[model samples]
Target: MNTSIFSRFQTRSHGGITLRASAFAAILCAALHAHAAQDIYFNENTSVSSPNRYLNESSNWYTDAGRTQQFEGTLSSDYNGIINTESKISASCASELSLNSLTYNIAAAKDYNNYFASLADNASITLAEDFNVNITFTPETGWNIQTIRMFHNGRITVGGDFNLTFDKNGSGSNGFLEFVIRNDSASAALTNRFQVAGDFNYTAVESGSRLRFVTGIGQFFVGGAMDIGNILWTINNPSSSEGANISLGGLTGTSGMISLGTGMASTMTFTNSAQREAKTTIGYTGDETTLNVTMRASDAKNGYQILRISSGAYGATDANLGDVIIDTGRLDLGMHSGMKGNYLSIAGVDGVFSATASDSGNIGAATFENGEWYAGKIAIDIEGELAYDKIVFNGRFEKTGSDRDMGFEFAFDAYTMRELISAGRGEFILEDVITYETGSSMAGTVFEGNTSGIQWEAVFGDTSLSVSFTVPEPAAVAAVLGAISLAFAALRRGKRA
Candidate 1:
């Protein structure tokens, strides 16, 4: 019963004690006044006149527990002004960070390391109109992100370099970092672009990450080593209407691979307007790889050569060129200019050169107008009987080396020695004959005359003879006849005596 008037409140009955209404209203007004002091609101089209507006009002953004801060309410900037901030400015909206026409310029030479760690998946940052802003996203160590999409509508000409570094968290893959340049304006004549005057370096540490450059109408020229898993170009409108091109400028001094298309069936056309050769090497680290080339230019009369072994790596097992099995897999070289003379040449340094056809395939079929077939050693081993349409040796068809007693068998349809006897070009001298059999009869098979001391006979039915005679001239024949008549007269006179 010693409570004071300030501590207790008297009700209408005075038996029950309750807090006074005026005191409760006073406490609520104080709480509301405190919250109103912390809350910052800006009307539509509110402009920031000074460049250091963010640094001037740092207390409004420093309420977060960590170095990262998130703007809680809907904040939009529609004025054409510049915001220079070293700290991170995250304008949160329901769907997009719609900077209507605000140019948010980051401070030069400052590393924004892990400042943009709070960007969510559904949140997209869009820079519209002539809002030329340059921002660098340099991740700190152990920074693993999912994706960060930046869509610029107008022009973003970064005066200095915008360096981006993606550090690998662990063995997992890093997410994509995409920059989209789109012309979101209604006017078709307006062209939006994003240009970097200084060097833009994007360094990736891991192998499973990708960097994509998407554009509706723009051109990207990357200079240095864009070391990512892949540099993807997603040209939305890739036609001539709104053409987009990404020039790599001949990736000099960089040792990496660039994957052109996304999937398996994607076709990438490589065309060279010049007359020089566009040569490409398809190499693999694995054991087996196949290269399929379908040349559809039937109208091209210029011959192209596919040299198989320009150089050789000779091994013990792979000592000869024949060891390399050139599998012409479904090759159809249809009547091209390459099918002319000297179509194929197989040459090697050492060992015998041989060509083989499989049981299922034919080696080739060609017609030679006038060409000599020369072989150092010709060995033909037929599995079955052999037949030739015609065998004509225009030159001397004689074995020139030492004659051995190997014993050979040769069957001919019709043997002729007329040219040898008449033209006196070559002599057919049979050294030895084991057995001789002819299909003709033996009535006058043997020759009865000699011509130029070279006599040849068509002997039939196992007859052998060793006779030599010299062909008499016209004067020699008359002298021989007169001598024979004189001898006959002398014999008759002797008998009468």
Candidate 2:
């Protein structure tokens, strides 16, 4: 048998000191080559038809038994060559992966654990062609990882399911699974494109877990349904401070929906500047869609505003683009900090619109600032046998001119108006009322014989009426009574004569 290079080095070390020094130099040279041989290279320009078996022992690839494999050169595959039996493959280089009219297919039903465990730092993947590819990873039992980051700058088309699982107790602080599609193309049309036709399921099983789908200057087009279960999915912009704008491309079907939480006490928050476009729309697919914010509690404190849209142009336009239809959720207007403006401002020339607060829900003070107060309508409907304190409209309740014919309808069972009078104020103006119906229990009721210092000025009519309340001075009431008594005594004397 031929003596190995390492064996020959050990044999010569027992000779003189000069031979021992030469033997050490030979061992150092062998170690350097072994380290350089660990990198696997694939050049598409040379032998494009050969199947580059990932586990071939005779090739330039290095494997740690059947556990892990690492590749270093630019990989351009045109067939099913990068297959994994029971090992995880990590392909990385200083530059990105160049896919040229090739399909980098991964074998199905194979459990390749921690596929990107040894990815080169700061290395990204680029797709040169708009071909189809499938990369699947089904982990075995008891496998946990911190994060898996995939940065692609090309048009990728997935042909199968893109399933990802973030195991419990696997991630710590600054640990998150993120997929970033950066725009590196000079052409505006082919900048950043990702289309997936299969089901995209991402599951996170830990607290403080976050899954982010970020895009630079391109759009994410999903041809199939996307289900993100129990992860705080943040859509971030690559350039500005605003959230990334996404187009759903009509992926939400009758049974498919883009759900955020797992029907629990979870939150999906959007943060940006105070502009209308900064507001995030849950169901902006331009179809009859439903955005479900499932709350497990019934208390108002427990049930927070599922959709908190805080911006200047929420209802600014007449087209009503991005009109959201929430399934079983509560809307909070002017709820965010430093957002104390109009709630709904609709231009009156389009058509008449109505804003209603019904079914035991509270609309807070100064909630409405109509563009034309007399043009639109406001309704406060109450059902069942319940009484409320008051519905305060703290802002202006007036018309454009002297025509006070604005529609204000109040339909309730039983309630009391809490003495709408200012102390020491003697006069109040009565505006036009469209409809007012006091129940039969309190019909024709006039509050009199009460020294509560309250006076009523009521104008009753067949169609419309207005009521005002004020406090009168004590001296004025006594002088009016004295004049009435003197007149009565003079009339008695004339009758006797």
Candidate 3:
């Protein structure tokens, strides 16, 4: 054999072969280093203030000035910074946005109220809990809660139907009061409804308590038991679509005052010809969805014009109303007979043609014009293609034609949107957003964002408007990829050497 060939085949006694293997490994690692530099990792806690950094660069996308109504972007923040959970966005006259998912640490004993209250805007807020979450809203006469899972202990006087549900926390031992409308008194005009679900025990908090259930009108003297799993009750009023539908499963504990109708009548009417209108629908069934509406109606001969339609708390006047109205075809209700009263209605609409999947908060194209009023009939469509089993809403309350001269202006006060998506615990997503007064009431010229009837026009002219979103921190993704590459390279080199 040739001397050189023999040398090539000869094993180096000084571990030359091992040295060669090491060099090859080193070269492989160097090549991996070049590739691994591209990997990235995204942190939810990463604070990004600039729109360009979190949006424009790789996440946010927007349209031109002529189309400023359209935009899409993704944001990252601690879970508590956004919504309480996987809740839907609250839509009002003003449009808003929210972060759907977030990451952060949560201790079981921490108060989540601050986090939840912080996100109250005209947008959807969601929080991902890392530990047992406990929240208290405190106790207030209007709206307050001291402890969740427990109803207020005092004589809770509710003018309107009060509904409460405490899942795992409510064990049947507790007691609560329920008030419903009764017609026994000829002067008492029956309006409003009440219902509760679950394997819960309900007691009459008051002896002379006027109560009405799915059955009929009667004074509730003792507590009642409800087991929605096998029994369901629906208090329906043939005169109006206002009633209670209660359904639930499992043991539930509740105690407190259950007041029926708007708690006070001084500012309201409760008699038959008393010009009274109040309704509530509360259900404990994990799946039983209910709709409620309260309107102030007058005798038909008085020229009935709708003043407001709201999901919650239709304020004193219509001039500065803030409610969510669906974007559908023009709201044209030719000619109807009724008196001067505020009306609010809710129904289902076409989900596919109306909204895109994965999208939550929505706006519509209804405009104000002519002496006649047009209002969108709202709906939460669950019929077909847009079959995410999601919720959709369209609300309209208008007064035009001759009734435009009504003195009081519309004022929309409170708005909220809540939904329970998770299967366990009180793992619900709730959006409670409110908009500050615009400093101006519904008045002035028709096209200047107001109509003769103080109608609120679209903030953005074109109704074909929507908000799009994108994922931020593309670098983080690159970091993760690079780390993965480095790990693989290390393993490869270790095996090769």
Candidate 4:
């Protein structure tokens, strides 16, 4: 550990100088090794373009329906045992009842003695049917009939139907009468008394199913499996903090925008999905139009952007944040091993790599390192082998603004009809075969392998692929050390003299 040995040795002219230069060279080599071990670099000139801005857009949208309702206190009367019931009760459920059945008092006049009363107790009572009768409670005051109690049930279930009412007319003095329908077989019973109030929510699923309340405040439409309660639709009521919230299951096949708010300005959730063929268009009222064309999930796995148009064929301006547009071309999923082409393409997206593939385009496995960043992972099928390639992150540095437009692209080879049929194992399967004319000499085949001589070009724009760095070269560094050593030797010799 004699640090001065090297310095003092430098003072020795001939032999010592050579040894000092050699030591300095060793230090320079070590520094070079350290610099070479870095991963990821940022090129300031280019930026990572947002992955095909339409990655989530599609042609068709999966849908589920629901409904909800709220009622306020209201007063109405039931006369002649006739209840005016509303028709067409859709998927509507009430939480509580404020007002159930109504009560009334009637009087029988004159001498209406021998009489009978009728009562109809049904779940739904209609005013079209009527019943009337009267009874006498007289001779005591030598006057007219005073009052009779009229009772009605809100929640009623009936096995049969009958008329319910009270009447008096035959004789002079009025008679006391009341209609009573037993809840034994076919009649309504008494239940809670509550009125339906507030707003009602309704959501459509398979097709056209609607629930009409007084006024609808909000509704929700989820695209996948879910558990629903009495309330069909729900909206995220951030203000109240107790209302319903909508959940999106997965990407659908069409483009759609969910809007929340009143008047012109509103918040929106845009989505789309495609099956065989579809068209999805989305945009704000004042924004530019954008459309993405894609294939079904089945097609995507088979190495085909079924739609001549692919996702991200369009650009994203400030107006396209929650807006998605897509169009699904044809059902040209070749008939081979249930193989269908996929048109969904993603570029310049950073995060965990999650993809599953089959056929020759299957991704066997992938490795993530250096912060576990998979720069670009593309799956394509060649012949019968699934080929997956992920660019390893060499290195990275500080960044500002948007992500760079970094991605990989592959060109496919053309195949003849005969080759496609034979390659698909007797199933007509073609990969990346477009009927339209194109610049590339690639041919189209219903069932065949991808084109040859295809090279993937990594697109780097706005940002540098490698981080900005400059390590001093060994020659330059050694020269600096040599000069320092010379200076030190002269100073030491001068002191010694």
Report the number of the highest-lDDT candidate: 2
- Per residue, candidate 2 scores C-alpha lDDT tens digits across 2-70 of 665555554543435447557767779988765442222222211212333222222433234232454
Best by TM-score: 2
Q: When superposed on Cα atoms, how far off is each prediction in RMSD?
A: 35.8, 25.2, 28.7, 32.6
Ranking by lDDT: 2, 1, 4, 3
| lDDT tens digits, residue span 291-326, model 1 | 122211112222121212111111111111101111
How many backbone clashes does every candidate have?
A: 0, 0, 47, 88
Per-model TM-score, in order, reads 0.25, 0.31, 0.19, 0.22
Model 1: residues with Cα > 4 Å off, grouped in runs = 1-153, 185-190, 221-230, 238-240, 245-497
Q: How far does residue 321 in candidate 3 sit from its true spot (Å)?
A: 18
The residue ranges of model 4 lying beyond 4 angstroms of the native Cα positions read 1-278, 283-319, 323-411, 414-453, 459-497
Better-scoring candidate (TM-score), 1 or 4: 1
312-395, model 4: which lDDT tens digit per residue? 211222122121111111111111211122122232232112222212232322111112111322333223322322222222
Candidate 3 residue runs with Cα over 4 Å from true position: 1-281, 284-289, 292-294, 297-446, 449-460, 464-497
- Per-candidate Cα lDDT values, in order, are 0.29, 0.32, 0.22, 0.23
